[model samples]
Target: MQTGISYCFLLGWLLCSCSETKSNHNQSIQDTAAVLLQQDSTSVFTTTALVEDTTVRFDMSEVPSEPDTKIKILEIGNFHNNEVWKGADNKQWYGLFQTTTGYYVKKTIVQVKTVYDALLDTKYVWSGKQVSVSDKDTCLLLITGISLPERNIDTVVMSQKTIWPSEKISFTVDSITYTLRATGKRQKISNEVSDYRLYISIIKDGVEKQQLLVVHDVFDDTMTVVMWVGDLDGDYKPDAIIDVSNHYNNHRPALFLSGEASEKEIMKKVAEFSQLGC
Candidate 1:
């Protein structure tokens, strides 16, 4: 929870050169999984481990972590500079400074489980070292980690799919029923472009558990895709990472971890990464 550790990020944490750029609309489920590895003695990225293919076949259950890996980074989030000091509850964080000089300085990293069989989204909290980096320009950090899985888990992931209005898909996990539904309306926003509003939600036993997404006034041609589906927090309940971007010219993906949800909610959105296309 210190303010000086970005080393916890997976080997290749994608640093943005500029904000709001075009994003990959067709990214696969594997792209959402961040595999964090531990560096060996006296070096950076000097370790290697064996990993199995995780293309996510329908017959697959759980994805395997590389044997030599350290913490399996689920999702890293930014709470803006002002929100860094307060932090989120029941969550962990690894912080780093985005210095005025436009570079990163490594500080601290806490070791978690070496092997991860499940992927979960997380919230965060930064501890100290706010002044260690200089006057500062940006505040950033990572999220929760647990020692090891209590038991082996089966694969509960589904491939990415574009969901249209009136189109719903159902699947079973942990003996619980789940349905992904999409509903929306279209309106003209401009002479050349139309506006749209889409409501994406989860249904269980004739009840709507949560309104996962409600994209409003999105540009024409925008579509929502259920990027990946499964238990993102290993809570046995379903969690998701979804793309509710304006498909033709934008990419806005959000990560939801079931473990962070409130009692009445099925999942809580802990992180969202976005970009805009010209």
Candidate 2:
């Protein structure tokens, strides 16, 4: 027949060119598995939006307690290692940092655990270290949540308390007395023209509350002091941690919390952290 119909039309065009090259090699492996599943769902939606944009929370009725256990999570920073936190979950947490050098020393109780970061999924921090910290000698000041009758009050008040201006420093703690007074007016700063400010007042029971703290233009002795007082949010009352940094090579701590104070306010700074020395 014409050479067998040209060999069956060349074997039906070589079986339709091997079925269109095996359907383009299975559509290039399904378009490379749909671009690797859209890049693994955009890398898990950008690590769940970087763990919800660096969480910070802390407002569960501002620590009213006993709903599912308190401490709404604080975790400010400087504890190091990628710093991302939230899971205190089992409760009971606190770091505080800074182990020595001025304002009466002592505050290194860091064990830490609760990590699971596939990009910060669960966190609390610093575990497995049987205590041997040295960020060239520690500094961090917060991590939050601790109450239960505890009172190390940074070595239970060792020393450093010279906040004068009109002079009036006092402290009683558990029985509650805290008096503090340091009005202002101690100038120097050639041309920034200053009032400099300082304000303190505090009083309690008889109620006085003023609190401005410091403004500084610099010069003359420069030391705000008062470093530590008891009951940091356990709510037994009196809580403090001022450094105000009139400068001793700069420290600036500032943290007061009488359980978020407010009958009209006696103490309520909540938090502050700063440190620098070269």
Candidate 3:
């Protein structure tokens, strides 16, 4: 019986040792798996960091910067004929005569009434000539003078005092439609009369922003502003065309480049009237 008890005890101890060895093996396998998982996570993190660095170091030097602001000044002349006329009855009349020296002389005629045998005859007498003058000349003559219709100074002054209506302008850039309102304001330049300033308002993406553009009048009565969209710089992006004219005779073209910030900036003055290939 003692021998049988010893064998049973030995068998029980052997079984317990086997269970402990199995548990140790399982624990070792679990630790190895955990280590492998940590290695894999570290490798993934390193690979992700390298990919981020490569993305951040991408080259962007080829993209062009903002172009320079080009300013062009143009001088406009008058559009009119110059000549003088003398009637067969010795009466003088003002006419337009084209000459190489470019001078326009306006002659005045005086009328005298005489009665002969209950008949009244009116005779025209030629007076001295008066030449057109400029602001710089105390007395001068203009060769290419434009004669506008005589305007009443009082009426013009009254009209100037009245409020002018705003003009609506629209253009498309890159398939996006843009609308602007030109509000008129008077601005005085140096040694010149008060000019009309077109304060522009831009509407984009359902938001309204002001002062996106402004056009200064070169002449008080003959100034005009025109806007359109075109690819002026050959960049394929739609550039804005701001054309200022004086009675459609002198054209000043300005270009606003297209980019991310173009909607909020002003245009650059480009070509004068003479530079246009018309």
Q: Which predicted model would earn the best TM-score?
A: 1
Work out candidate 2's RMSD over C-alphas: 17.7
lDDT of all predictions: 0.44, 0.51, 0.38
lDDT of 3 by residue, 150-203 (tens): 211110001121122254555555555555554454344532323445544445
lDDT of 3 at 205: 80
lDDT of 2 by residue, 1-278 (tens): 99999999999999999999999999999999999999999999988774434543222222122223233223232222222223332344454444454322232344334323233233432221012222334433443444434334432453447555555656566665556665555435532222455554455577666666556665344557666666554556766677777656556677776677677666766655444332
TM per candidate: 0.41, 0.25, 0.30
Candidate with more favorable, higher lDDT: 2 or 3: 2
Regions more than 4 Å wrong, model 3: 1-165, 185-195, 199-201, 234-237, 245-250, 259-263, 270-278
Better of 1 and 3 by lDDT: 1
Candidate with best lDDT: 2
- Tell me the spans in candidate 1 whose CA falls farther than 4 Å from its real position: 1-160, 186-212
| TM-score computed on alpha carbons, candidate 1 | 0.41
Residue runs of model 2 more than 4 Å from their true location after superposition: 1-93, 96-181, 188-231, 252-276
Residue 72 alpha-carbon offset, candidate 3, angstroms: 7.9
Give candidate 3's error at residue 99 in angstroms.
36
